[model samples]
Target: MDHLGSWRFLKVFLPAVFALHHFCHAETAPYYSFVQEATSAPLVSYYDYIIVGGGTAGCPLAATLSESANVLILERGGSPYLDPINKTDKENFFLPLLDPSPHSYAQAFVSEDGVYNHQARVLGGASVFNAGFYSHAETDFIKEAGLDGSLVNDSYLWVEKKVAFKSPVLQWQSAVRDGLLEAGVLPFNGFTYGHINGTKIGASIFDMDGHRHSAADLLEYADPMKIKIYLHATVPKIMLITEIGSRPRAEGVIFEDALGVRHTAFLTKDSESEIILSAGTIGSTQLLMLSGIGPAHQLEALGIQVVMNQPMVGQGMADNPLNGLFIPSPLPVEVSLVSLVGITQFGSYIEAGSGLNLAPSLVQWISKSLVTILNQTEAKVNSSSLLGARLKVGIIIEKVNGPISTGHLELQSTNPNDMPKVMFNYFQAPEDLRKCVQGMETLINVVNSKAFSKFRYPTISTQDLLNLVATLPLNLRPRHLNTATSLEQYCLDTVMTIWHYHGGCHVGKVVDQDFRVLGVDDLRVIDSSTFNFSPGTNPQATVMMLGRYMGIKIQQDRHS
Candidate 1:
């Protein structure tokens, strides 16, 4: 095809290519009984698989397990389906993440390290609130986790067929893609769901119309008769039956409803029945400690009965450190989530999002967040000032490749609903800071690339524009700093999260290769909590895959 023909083809059909691959995949979500309120739940219940947290991993795991076993999902938050702020439209993408009300889809929290972050409180978990970029786990991560190679691919297909959509490379993303290639990120892999070291367009959880398809949608694979999902049901502790000479067995769980009434849900007497914690990184780790499976000292101090003396339950917590540069588009840039990602060999990944017409919801969030993003003493130019202003902007961002710097989690309160006191010592390790600098350098190179020339004004020089954005940082260093020290400082002062935090219930430390808790029986952790690092560019793909992969493995193990 000629260059014009190729361009026409790509713009029209690239997004549909991967989207249409799921046809061979059978069935939609069965009309499973969705219990919105926990009050209606019977005081007692039994299932072959008692999965906790109906978020990204839980939903897929439950669906897959229900193929043969009865499953029960106890979710802390209610459904996001009827939520006004959690709409599927592209513009509503940031709204679910920004709303801070107690009942909002996103739950607001500040780390003990003083970083502000949000966790998904809605049923679909982070997948509902995330930027929706989808990609596979790194080969190294898969092998290290002892995942079966072929099974991993199959699991990815199963999840992608249901949730992932092929995203088209629009104007801003196309520019970013070319800029990455110009900067020598070689062997441009055009579009893939697999993790590769190159500039590529990955699948998105958002569809052709930019409507999101979260992990909650993966429930379609469930056997309607075999799955019972309880929304607004908070699992506080894993109910255990201890014997003096035998390992503690997780027999059931104690949970609370929205009305504060507590109930017990049990696993069957079947020897292979299990309690799976897919409550995400924070939720799983915190729940483990709350259930008396953490360090003996911490539990003793908190006045909790100890189930197992496991010291690594909440250790090695980390979040991918992120920083960005805001560039003004010469023309109005269409709003887009991540469509292009530049996976560099250096320990960083570059990606971008663009929008000119932002909704009013962004003003409050921007006012608070930009204060820290700009590293200012206060909001010099709050979002309040831009109430009706029509400004065009594109943001270029990079995540420092990691499980680099690590921290630990300790309980703040015994209440299961309270946020845990965890610290992700961002850039604390010298290597992490070095990677951050390398990423920032790569970002600068992209901005100055000839492919990005159209976004800048003809009058202003590239160096001048960078100096202006660089001035957003405090400490008034040289206006145009080319030194590594300035870049390192910028990373330190403005470090935020891509929300790809992992660890806590790390495999090999807290759990065995099969995801079973090291010191307990009939209990396993099957979420991002089991990861040593966040997988690939985004973790949702790997997380959902893990759920399905493990469900199949567990079924196989039961048969064997």
Candidate 2:
């Protein structure tokens, strides 16, 4: 055939083959139907509601809202469905954490006190990146939050059906459960979701087949035509219109796409049309402060025009503190995330997991954490020393249900791209330290129990343990060495965030009971930031429940 004739023939042939392939594989395609690239979004769009941050809370809230009204979700990151390396494969789970590319799913951040943390910059938010441990908040926490009992209860079911799953009990997890019961964390609750005061096997996002069902799965609830999800869309500011004496109102938002093209999205003429910030803890608080709904002094310092002098916008941030004991196992254990939890009498939650091959980035992180804990110079200890072995079991002791010693978030500058300054003032309160100490003691007791003996091979001697604990950076070490004091100091030095950061724009202070941002018209925060207090559990389940409840509440209010 001639060159021109051949070119025309190839065009016709390629598309036919492509279409045939797509048709054959249609059933295997990812389930997100309404998502679009940021560049594809219209330059000027209108919606009844605009949800910033297509994350754990934002995804569900947007899906629910779309059932009643048009909704727009502007996410700063790409879709997890598009990134199989980071989102789908269980063996390559840590790839996202190790990735430092501009488009990496996990955006790394550091706390002011030097602890490192990462936040998900994907459509499913942290739900795509977390360990997938699912647990409901304690009954006491529900009552404390003043949430409607029935609504909270029903909301869990709504989220659970979409994302939660029962993780199979493996060898390591079974041993941990037995050890917890042996340690007096009695009343084994088998394969339940309730966060009761006893050892329990809970639901997980990772299923038996090892595929994670993230909160993004909840997008199935959205009305496809009514929902517009734009990935890689960064909202810089919430546009507001104000009068001399009248309060400020959010009219729209200005966002930038991946190609650096700017666009605007506005609310409908309806007075009830609203803007919701579901940008997790840090992102939501940062966006609020950037949009002038933060401390007067802080905003003024950054030269950001103040919309409202809400001092509490970036204050009262809290993170669940975690300390763990690593047990080297001679036998290989199944690769798993959180499945079994021990709710101790001393106000701590104990969970166990196995089979994590630490990524290079995590190894570096462990080295830094060890340096801080041991008060040693960088040369003395390296990442290899901490994570040399494979086949290791981790006993994670978390001070989930304990005293809430909060922290604060501060803006580095007016730039939205610049990371915010986070200060999780862990162990600041006397009660918080006491709780951590008690939790550490409980972990020691559990490890020493005969139930754990079968798996625990004397990896480190008692003297070595004492020496390791004695080298902790905490100044207040007992003059005469003892296991109790050593463990307490180790906890003080080694405690890190479990990634359960909450309460920046909390209820009563930043937002109202209904989640409306205080003093701001037509705006609300419905993420972890809106949490009144940290629920004493893994927090993903509670956050999703809150998202569902808020979504339903908004729908009800609109109808009424």
Candidate 3:
């Protein structure tokens, strides 16, 4: 057998894991392994490609590239298994986001705008904690990104077969679907994965049994011998070489294992060897700034060496502005997570999630926000008082499109663990607010529809429903739509996140259409971070596709 064939055959029988954990032992013994602790890696290693952030995009990217090259993945967090937070059962859907541990799969951060959001620290990235709704990137999105339409479709197919599944619509979701149709959202598209303008039962990354299949599962598609992933490996900076006549080029990365031991992973001598950052919106931008590739002034301010003086590294920060109402179900509703959606003529997408199991702390956490929002001094609030007895409530939400409003991320300290100061300035743009208002109007119609009468109060008028939301602490969510605050203020006041935030290393500003950093060579940012807009209602599907799409492009580039 050829060397490649021999390696492949050898890995099958030789224990799928490598335990040569010591730096010295690993350095001397070259072997094949999968999903190893960072401690198992050598102090110094080389690869044809190195991907930072073994996340939604990173997993597929590393997997695809491994077909013809050796790849190393450095992830800042631990495995997604053996933790209640990472459990895929529908009942535990929100556990990952609510996990109190500082080192859990999801890391909570309050944006400068004071909006609570999450960053995924686990290997699978945010896909591990997300709603699991799957949708395709709009055709307009494909064209806007200058991607090959055919390749985009094929990439979507590749991801769908691996992760996407038919969403099982239960009672609450069925009522939601009927309500959307009755509300005149448009001709129903039925069950589909397409990004369309109508009510549709799209796909889900969760299987029929409720087991979540995240991007990490895509690693199985990789060439076993050519891929090595290090969990709990934090990359502090990208190593760059600045030649007098040439642009700055990324050569490797400096990462620290869980033990705080530093190590270097360099690229092979091949001219095509590249370093890609699949770290999400915040991580990719933060790493770029930390590695001296962002605003020179900002870098210098943080005591970081400026390499490229790229001023737009952390610019164009934005998130979909979400507004929703919590309706206390009069009857028991089956547990579901956004199984039905209503795409309005306006730029908003309306979706619903049912049987939300909100814990007392989560209820209190949200109640605190509500208590402050209600200026009435006499308004007393507690979890039980706000939610009554059961925390089970149906959440109906709409996200405005083209939040066109933009913000920037500023590094506070040089510390990699310290979250960047980000303010998406949600609904700063007039269009986003208009869309939110319109979307909310349609959502009210859905609630008032006859099909949903079973769940909502029969006597409750639209205004009464709004008043009802005001009473729920979870309803106390960005959403404070006061102009007394931008555009009516309700959007800003109630605007919570469905967690679909993108931009930072955006196309045209930070990276080229090919996702290569504009001022650097052999370094690429390949995540939703590079997107100018969040594609469709969900970006995870597209994020996963991008990894496969670009992996093919990069492999093709090597051949050329």
Counted clashes in each candidate structure: 1, 0, 20
Off-target runs (Cα >4 Å) in candidate 2 are 1-29, 85-88, 361-395, 462-485
Model 1: weakest 10-residue lDDT segment is 22-31
Tens-place lDDT per residue, model 2, 1-560, is 99999999999999998677656544323556679899998899899999999988898888889888999999999987655433454545666776789888889877886666888798889888787888888887888778899998898999988788887888778878887888788888887888777889889887677777777888888899999999999988999889788888999999999899999999999878999999999999999999988999999998999888998888888887777665545455677778888887777888767777566655454444444543432233333444543334354455646546888999998777778999888778877777777776677777777877766545443333334434443222233445425665566566666888888897899988888887879999888887756675688888888888889999999999
Better of 1 and 3 by lDDT: 3
Candidate 1's C-alpha runs over 4 A off are: 1-32, 356-391, 458-485
lDDT value for model 2 = 0.78
Per-residue accuracy of model 1 over 435-480 as CA lDDT, tens digit each = 8888888888898889998886544444444444454532222333
Per-residue error for 388 in candidate 1, Å, reads 4.2
Looking at candidate 3, what is the lDDT of residue 91? Answer: 62
Between prediction 1 and prediction 3, the one with superior TM-score is: 3
lDDT of each: 0.80, 0.78, 0.81
lDDT of 2 at 45: 88
Q: Give me the overall lDDT of model 3.
A: 0.81
User: Model 1 lDDT vs. the true structure?
Assistant: 0.80
Error of 2 at 44 (Å): 1.0
